[model samples]
Target: MHFKDLFVNVSETLSFTTILLGVGYLAAFIVSVLVISENRSPAKTLAYLLLFFLLPFLGIIIYYVFGENYRKKKLYRLKALEDEKLQKRLNAYVYQRSEEKLKENELQLKDYEKLVRLLTYEGRFPLTDNNHVQILINGEEKFPVLFDALENAKHHIHIEYYIIEEGFIVDRLFDILFKKAAEGVEIRLIYDDFGCSLSKKFLKKIAEANIRAVPFYKIHIPFLSNRQNYRDHRKIVVIDGEVGFVGGINLSDKYQNEGMNNELFWRDTHLKIEGEAVRSLQLFFALNWSFCTDEGLFFQNEYFPKYEHAGDKKVQIAVSGPDSDHASIMLSYLSAISSARKCVYLTTPYFIPNESILNALKNAALSRLDVKLLVPGISDSRFVNAASQSYYEELLECGVRIFRYKKGFVHAKTMIVDDVISMVGTANMDIRSFDLNFEVNAVVFDEEINQQLKQVFLEDLHQSREISTAYWHRRRWFKHFFESMCRLLSPIL
Candidate 1:
């Protein structure tokens, strides 16, 4: 074989390979474009196209990271419409329930009206005298309150959370539940499989005690689907028919202690609503149970028992999830902001705002409404932090006051308007909380409750340092670019 013979054979093979690759690339490109265009924004469509052009293989992988949902926007819209219908039905029922008591609770008429409208709009457990709300701040406040409620469990104790750990805090809570179960207290625990997988053994212990510890939306474990998209981000503990808990706090030691787990001094907030609100929380739990277990859990005699409005505060519950397209809780937040006469004070661990929320904040500031934002001094999510910080300059320029909580992390998700009506619960100021994640937020209207939340907010505020417009302008341009990019993807994120 001479050099000339070898060159001819190799060149012919190379030509054939090139042609095959080109044809394959074109096929994939066309398929991806067709698939992506079905539901994505124009910007996302173009971003994807450019990526595919630059690196076909890696671009597809990135698509896999973000290109979920069969037809996200379409599905979202359908869910939203269905939710709207549910909202109307729910509102009617609530109004009927409250209208009867509206005259009795006449002094709190505006509060009741707000509660009914907010609950109806948000699909929160319709306000009932049989339910009550207990505002549980940190672990010091939540644990003792929750433990006592668990101890008093009668017919059943329904528990569901996004994160359930096996730490000392969880162990203590589990022990109380375990002993209560032995004493004829029915206990059903549901934790998100993905979120609580780390505590599988602890969950197993509950199962071993003849208690139901079901993993929701579980993967690969026989019955459950691996869809892994929607999760039970809600944290609610319903004890019999009289007591309940809902909010940001999870069943984890880190949230309770200085224990570290990728995050330091974990800060989060939660609610303990007894009385009629507990029934609403229980209803929310039942709906989730129906979705996950396929068992119809109507508020039958088994679940419903006699109770009264143990608390005087006018409270409304708001819930949002993948099942609902309207982003009800987020809408409620916007409503609060829009109606805010003097100030809008909000605190969250994550501050990544969606376009509508971002625009609302900007406009609120521009309108000269006192807008103060509180976030962690040390953030757990850098990308989210950058995205949050990205809005500082414009906000500050428009007279918005920003504060970084010097305390470890401000996980309390509270939003107060005119410093009168305050909301405290699991919902954060981000698209994830607004649109993607399941969340529960409480709306409190009574002056006393408002003052209580305000005092706590003020104490937290004392620990926060104001971020000046000058300081915001000093941030690197690259950071701004990254945040802006992150903001663009906020819708899908």
Candidate 2:
């Protein structure tokens, strides 16, 4: 109990605490340096830096889980190589004619030639002719057509989706799949592990039915799974290499509004493509299948059968993800907006665009282009909704017209630009879709399809409440501040 002894003990405790603090700050500094070295966008780098410094150990955990800018290329490199080999083997004729098609498209589309070429080089998605594209609105139209296509699969059926929730719709889907399997038609399915909840019993049923199925980037533990950040968000269906479907609609009952009383009607868009475009969809599926199952489908002639002039529509498939060398979908969107000579109409469930897209819309509006955006009034995530709203004031100030759909969630990710192109696919106007997830869009370059999508967008406007600058600026100050705060973290959201 000596006073000198007590003083020594307290000094030792203080020394330990100081050493711990020093080590923690040193680790945070190292991580911050690494984040900067990743050469991420300025906003993302700053957000991650703020998190690392402000929250101490917690920030380190979050960054470890989600912030590391790791590309999935190493895992997908084989798929990429296989795709390259396949393209050389099967598409030499298409590539040979691509220049001629480019010229034809340049003359046909006029201002969209640059956009077409950008996708050709950047996305590695060749423009194809002899495509028949049908714009399917909502699940009501999509399911009937999809079921019929599934029922008619003579060779093989490849289905991939982010969600395949168990419901009557999925039950019916399985029934058809089982019948197809029994009929000796090859069936393969890929579902996102993070997005779908496939019961063990249901998975057992899938196995028993002799239908090959796998989950993309399977996660065992939810909390400790860092791979959950990168997801396969594409919804694609390729049947017999003749028919294909791509869009935002997942294989879930909620996507269909039939027989619903109080449930929110999910507004969405899908493309039913029959022609050369189906080969592109099948190509993506095969690449993803190779990644997930290590099974090469590159040489299957039935999976890539020759088509005999299905229609006259021209279509190109745009796909992007961490595996991609560039953010192809985002670049395509930027090109579409920048190439808009008259109007830019966009409808999305999420609207957390990056700096380029945000500025592109503002610039288009400032140039007196008729720019319109339709977003969801009732978003499933409040954080995403608030962050989306934060961009509106600036857009409105620049004379951009913004509308909020009131009837239900407008989950359609579609854009119509100047009656030249219509884009419908899974990529949202957000950082997640642009950079993190696997996404695909069918870009249609037909006047008929463009006009149809434009008309649908106009009809959607009737149900959306347009936001006036006066009305937006008059909102409460706290709401604005909260939205701004959320916007600051949007790059990583």
Candidate 3:
């Protein structure tokens, strides 16, 4: 029983244990790499790989919690199949009608034919005429119109929002919804579980009041649910299948400047549509409702009731989500920017653009088109803000004028091209909105509305501070380093 012999034996045992741990880490890393690569982009794959390599145990836990590929899940696959079937059934008829309408007003829509065709063929969004669109500047203007439409709901009311915090505005909206429900009006609601975070009692109260409320992709097991990353970010309100509203303004006090904190002011854009265009929003709601509740409600005639002619604006609803192969809304923006013959104007809170959109903006600026982008001077998320600023130098170098809204947070996600096309929606110019969240935008092909949007953009510029190329280049070294780090993580942000 010599001490030297015992020491040698202990050293050998410790070495064996270390080898076993190394093998386990290698196995976990390999499995994570395989699973994440199924649907993630190269940038994301590399980021996750680096994460796992740096911290094996923690990265494995993080990947299991957040990096699960929901695209490979059967639930989303089934939903996509259902959407495709519905689109296939209606696309041909819609395309034919759009073509006929274009021929009838060839001269008026001639400039927008290519854009219309792009949305139709790629996004499967059919352009419909005889629609009316009202540009709502912020929640101050939008809420009143929305409340009036809700108060006038005769048949049914449908609402879907990412965030529906309990507040003054939400309480008012709930009271109205309850009143309408009591009056024999059918009410359906879909709110995101992560975004809304309402208690069971609140949801039960709404259910007891005769409103069919459902949480989108409900998280049955809390943190165990990988579906948290794919949120239903759309803010939609449809009344009697005739009038609808969509935009970035969620149902919360923060959206309204009066209800907001004294130091904060909310700036956003929403659209009020009446006519056949409302049907597209209705369809989006119905499909999402069906997916969330597992109910075959898309065939209900009440949700798609025939509409009387409202106005003469042509509109289309472009939707994108994890269920789709391509980022339809992002592509729509890229197309609009690339097709701009006069100018391109855009406003968004998050300006983290993907390669395609960045290239489009650069090319548009290089072509001497007046390209302008407005972002918030102060963002809610510092990392996101830094990532947004990281692109300022490149865009400014290419002749793109960048402005930061100093009055308040510019939460509006809008784009206007050539004074002929305008889009307002929930999608931001970021990877999360384009690839992860379910978003819908109203694509308007009308000169009048586009001009109005252009005017609004100009007014916003008055409240913003323009970032000159020289100023961007002269940023401090530490600031550049911090922004570069944020940009590195922007792909997965």
Candidate 4:
């Protein structure tokens, strides 16, 4: 064939391939727009649209893998229905008692009553009194009490954790669990598959011991499932439905500084609760377990065994996740911050705040409320750290004192407002914790516990280096540029 004929054939083939590619891109873009338009967040929709238009093929793949709204998918509707039924069953007696108690102590709890009602009505969290709470500072303080509770459990033990790595602490806990299971005590354990990378054999071993161990939203094909992004980040352990533990510390050695690993000293906080509050924790665990395994669990008297009055502390267990339209935990935080009369103190490992929380903090600071934040000096994620730092200047300018914990990584997700209210649990100051991950927080309205947490905050402050407005503004140009880039991706981070 002649050269001219060959060139003409090649050009025709290229034209046909280009037309097909253009049609494919158009199809993908239309599908993306149709799917993403259902959500209410304009910023997130715009972000998705921009990514689709910029890189149609890869962007669609990424969105399919991580961007699907689990709430809209109705992934946890069954669990929610079960929860509603349980709530209805308990509503009559629980609310009546709660109201009577509130009226009796109206004068003392006047300031925190609104918050209690908010959680009760909006978050579906029950406010209960006659509870005892102990604040555990770190793993060193938390493990011993947790182990003792496990050893003493007489009935059933329920545990749900985000991460349960293979380590000395976990092994020790597992031994106790195995022994308890062998003793005919009911044991049900739920761990997030994405967060806990334990071997299948390990899970099988627990199952062989007659313990019901299930993974929360297990990934069947890993990269293909959108559920990988939404994790059960709660760390809860209910022993015999009487004593319970909840907080930021997972079952791992990193949380403990035994001079074994080269990692920095870890700081965290957890709570041990006894009395009616443990019933709430037990309910939370049962609901989550039912969600993960399709097991029908109902509230029974056995799970809420009558206990002697432990103390006079008031506590509520606030939960939030993608199952609901409202971010309950974030709303709770906003309520606490807005209601602050004297001060707001918080410590979190990640500090990527959404616009509402950011604005809340800024407004609180501008109002001359002593708003303070303690974050890690060295973060685990570079992108998250940069995104967190990007907001430092704005918060600092608004008089929100920001502190970088220099002694170690401050992993405690805790808050204290006006020495009247305290919150400690697994929710971080990030979008994921508020919207994607299932999180639980203990909201305590006891002045004694609040003051104790406040003192702990002051001690943490002594170890943290305050970030000055001038120093934050003096960052290098490249660093600012990088942070700005990371901030743009903060919505999905």
Per-model TM-score versus the true fold: 0.84, 0.94, 0.92, 0.93
Q: lDDT tens digits, residues 426-464, model 1? A: 778886677557778777666666677767777878988
Please write out the lDDT profile of model 4 over residues 1-493, one tens digit for every residue. 9999999999999999899779768967786768667864665677677677777787778878987776777677536445566558666656666677678779877877777777776666577888999999999999999999999988899999999999888999999999998898999889998899799798888889999988888889887888778889999999878899999999998887764573689899999999888987887787787787777885677787998989999888899888876888999999899889899998999988888999999999999999999999978899999988899999999999999999888899999999678999999999889888899999998889998999999999999899998888888999999998778777767
Ranking by lDDT: 2, 4, 3, 1
The root-mean-square deviation over C-alpha atoms between each candidate and the true structure, in angstroms, is: 4.6, 2.8, 3.3, 2.7
The model with the greater TM-score, 2 or 4, is 2
- What overall lDDT, based on C-alpha atoms, would model 3 receive against the true structure? 0.85
Residue-pair clashes per candidate: 15, 0, 0, 0
Clashing pairs in 4: none
lDDT of candidate 1?
0.71
Using alpha carbons, what is the TM-score of model 4?
A: 0.93
Q: Of models 3 and 4, which has the larger lDDT?
A: 4
Give the higher-lDDT candidate: 2 or 3. 2
Highest lDDT scorer: 2
In candidate 3, residue 432 scores what lDDT? Answer: 89
TM-score of candidate 2 versus the correct structure, residues matched by position: 0.94
